[model samples]
Structure formats: C-alpha cells, structure tokens
Target: MLAYIGKRLMQSVITLLVIITIVFLLLRLLPEEGYLGAAAEKMTPEQQEVYLTNLGLRDPILVQLGNFYSNLAQGDLGKSITYRTDVPVVEIIADKILYSLFFGLGAVVLALLIGVPLGILMAQMKGRWLDRLGTGYIVFVVAVPAMVYYLLIQVYVTDFFRLPMLFDEDRPISWILPLISLALGPIASYAMWMRRYMVDELNKDYIQLARAKGVRERTLMFRHVMRNAFIPMAQYLPATILFTITGSIYIESLYSIPGMGGLLVDAIQRQDNAVVQGLVLIFSSLGIIGLFLGDIVMSLVDPRIKLGRGESVR
Candidate 1:
C-alpha cells in the first residue's frame, strides 16, 4: 500500500509539472499587452521593451521557465498583471476562496442529505409512484441545460419566495439560491448512481440467497445490498467532494458570488495571465490530489481490493 501511494504521489507531481509548464508556455504566446495592462497604450515601443525586459519577459524561455520553478518552490505564485494589478496572485485567491468554500460546502451537504435518501427511497419503492417521481426528477435535472434551470430559479423562485436575486453577504437569505443551483447537478448525479447501484445489488444471487434464507427485507436492503453497492461508489466520493468544493463557475458568476470560479472567469476575460496561471495551477493540483485520495479511500473501504500488485484477496 505504501509503495502504491508513493508511486501515485510521484505520478501526480510529474503530471502537475507538465500541466504547469504547458500552461505557462501557452500564456506566453498571448500578446505582450496582457503583461502591461492599460499602461501599455501610452508607452513607446522602446519603453514597452524596457518594461517587458524588467519583468523578465525578454529572457530566454528556458531561463523564464527556470525562474518560474524556482519561485514556485518558494511559494511565490507571482502577481496579477491586469486584474487587481500588482497584487500577489496568492493574496487575491486567498481573499476569494472563502466564499467558494462556504457555498461549495453547503451545496455538497445539501446534495448528500437529499440525494442519498431520495435514491434509497426510489430503490425501495421500485415500480411504484415514488420511484417514478424520483426518476422523473433525475431525468429532468439531467436532461435540462443547467443554465436554464439556474436562471429560472434565480428569476421565478426568488420572485416567489421574496428572496434576493443575487448573492449578498450581509443578507444570509441571499445565499440560498446560489447554493441550491450549485447542488442541483450533484443531487441528480448522486441519486441516479445510487439508485442504479442498489438496484444492481438487489438482482445479484447473494441477495436471492439471503432472501431465501428469510432475511428481513429492510435488513437485507441496508446491510447487504446497500453496503456492497456503496463499495464502488466510495472510489468517486473523494473526487466528487473535492471538485464540488472548488465551486461552480456558472453558478458563482450568475449569483455574483465573488468566488474562485468567478475570479478565474474574470481573469480570463480581462487577460490577467498571472491570475489565470495561478488559478489553473491550483485547480490542477486539487484534481490530482483528489484522485490520489480516492484510490486510498477505495482500498480502505473494501478489503477484497488490494493496492499492491499481485495482492488481491478473494
């Protein structure tokens, strides 16, 4: 297990480095004006060249790459070049991450609480009205474009409930719409997958044998069916939770939530290369970490699964 973990960690590091290098090189291909901001308009070619040189933009690509890595090793993510000019990228992200974290956490909690039970109920009541109702909801959520529902919720729901249309930190009630919007997709996803897994478990021979042995339906459902069904789901839980906590870009932007998601969008629109680079690096790192943790979690949840080669148990 330790060896497997070590191997994964090394792979993650290599992947991250490759992603960062690719993004850095690509950003360099953008026009130099992104690095100078509005001030570039006033500067003569000579002055601009001088400015770019001072910023080390004129350095050889190899040298710049070396410098980037050196600074990265020391935790310096550089400064925002256009969006909130001169501010450290880390500082900008730190100021914005809390909002994303708060809403993201709320959304995940809401999704789990509602989605899991809905799935279980649907599974227990298969071929009944309740099952059909849950299935309909899942279908609607999955089929509809997210933006349409998000806008409807913002417009109609807010109007009906007399809630604020946009996010307002001072008005706690305003947080509701955005949180709900963020959770909708996840809720549908969890419900559909949970129901499918439970139903699959119910059809297996083990379940038939247990039923033949006179195990109570409820006991068999929860202890045997759900337990085994959840093993495969465990592999994705960490990744799902981690990604959810990173915030939804469309939801955050629609609600004007001032989160990491919106920040990335704003940086891209404004051509803030530094901020974009920093956010991309952070996001990529999180994705890698999430996958790494997911593997460990799956191994821990099911003893039959082994991380090391040639070590599977029947």
Candidate 2:
C-alpha cells in the first residue's frame, strides 16, 4: 500500500509538471499585452521594454520556466497583472476560495443525503412508479443542457420559493438557489450510479444464495447488496467530492457568487495571465490529488482489492 501510494504521488507530480509546463508555454503564445494589462497602451516602446524586463518576461523561456519553478517550490504563485494588478495570486485566491468551499461542501452533502436514498429506493422499487419517476429525473438531468435548467431554476424556482435569484453572503436565503443549482447534477449522477450498482449486486450469485436462504429482502438489500455495491462507489466519492468542492464555474457565474469559479472567469475576461495560470495549476493539482486519494480509499473500503499487485475483486 505504501509503495502504491508513493508511485501514485510521483505520477501525480509528473503529471502536474507536464500540465504546468503546457499551460505556461500556451500562455506565452498569447499576446504579451496580457502581461502588461491596459497600461500597455499608455507605455512608450522603451518603457514597455523596461517593464517587461522587470517582469523577467524578456528572459529566455527556459530561464523563466526555471524561475517559476523556483518560486513555486517556495509557495509563491506569482501576481495578478490585469484583474487586481500586482496582488499575489495566492492572496487573490485566498479571498475567493472560502465562498466556493462553503457552497461546494453544502452542495455535496445535500447531494449525498438526497441522492443516495433516492437511488436505494429506485433500485428496490424497480419497474414501479417510484423507479420510473427517479429514472425520468435522471434522464432529464443527463439529457438537458445544464445552462437551460440553471436559468429556469434561477427564474421559476426563485419566484416560487421567494428566494433571491443571486447569491448574497449575508442573506442565507439567497444561498439556496446556488446550492441547489450546484447540487442538481451531482444528485443525478449519484442516484444513477448507486441505482445501477445496487441493481447489479441484486443479480449477483451471492445475493441469489442469500435470497434462497430466506434472508429478509430489506436486510439482503441493505446489508449485502448495498454494502458490496458501495465498495465501487467509494472509489469515486473522493474525486467527485473534491471536484465539487472546487466550485461549479457555470453555477457560480450564473448565481453571481464570489468564488474561485467566478474568479477564474473574471481573470479570463480581463486576460490576467498570472491569475489564470495560478488557478489552473491549483485546479489541476486538486484533480490529481483527488484521484490519488480515491485509489487509497477504494483499497481501504475493500481489502480484497489490492493496490500495486495488479489484482482486484472487480
């Protein structure tokens, strides 16, 4: 297990380096004006050269990359150029991350609480009205473009619930819409996967033998089917939960929430290259970390699934 963890950690670091390098090079391809900001228009040619020189932008790409890595090793993520000129990227993200964290955690908890139960019920009630209703909801959520439903909820649901259409930090009621919007997709995902896994478990040979031995249906479903089915689901929970906590870009933007998602959007619109780069790196690292943790969680949940051994129960 330790070996597996070390291997995964090393792979994650290499992947992160590759992503960072690609993003850095791509950002360089963008017009240098992105680094100079609106002030680029005001500066004389010599002044622009001087400014770029001070930023080390005039350095060779390899040298700049080396410098970036050195600073990264020390926990400096550079500074915002356009969005909040000269502000440290880390500080900018710090200001916004808490909002995303609060709403994202709320959304995930809401999703798991509602979705898991809905899925269990749907699986148990297969071929019945309840199952059909749940299936319809899953289909609707999967088939519809997210933007359409997001707007509809913002308009109609807000009207019906007498809730604010946009998020307001001080007004708890206003938080409802964004949380609901953020949770909807995850709820559908969790419900669909849980129902599928449970249904699969129900048809397995062990479940059949248990049924033949006169195990109560409820007991069999929960104790045997759900327990085994949840092992596979555990593998994905960490990644899903982590990604959700990173914030939903569209939902945050639509609800006007001041969060990491919206911050990225604003940075892009302002062409704040440093901020964008920093956020992208953070997001990439989180995704890799989530996946790494998911693997460890899966092994812990099901001891038969051995890591670094090329063997798994399923």
- lDDT agreement with native, every candidate: 0.88, 0.89
Stretch of 10 with least lDDT, candidate 1: 305-314
List model 1 lDDT by residue over 194-255, tens digit each. 88999999999989998999999989988988888788777777788778877588888999
lDDT of 2 by residue, 1-314 (tens): 78878888999999999999999888878877777777888999999999889988889999999999999999999998889888999999999888888888899999999999999999999999999999999999999999999999999998997889888889999988888888998899889999999999989998899889999998998788999988888888888887997758888899898899999999988878788889998889888888988888988888888888765522
What is the clash count for each candidate, in the order shown?
0, 0
Give the top-scoring candidate (lDDT): 2
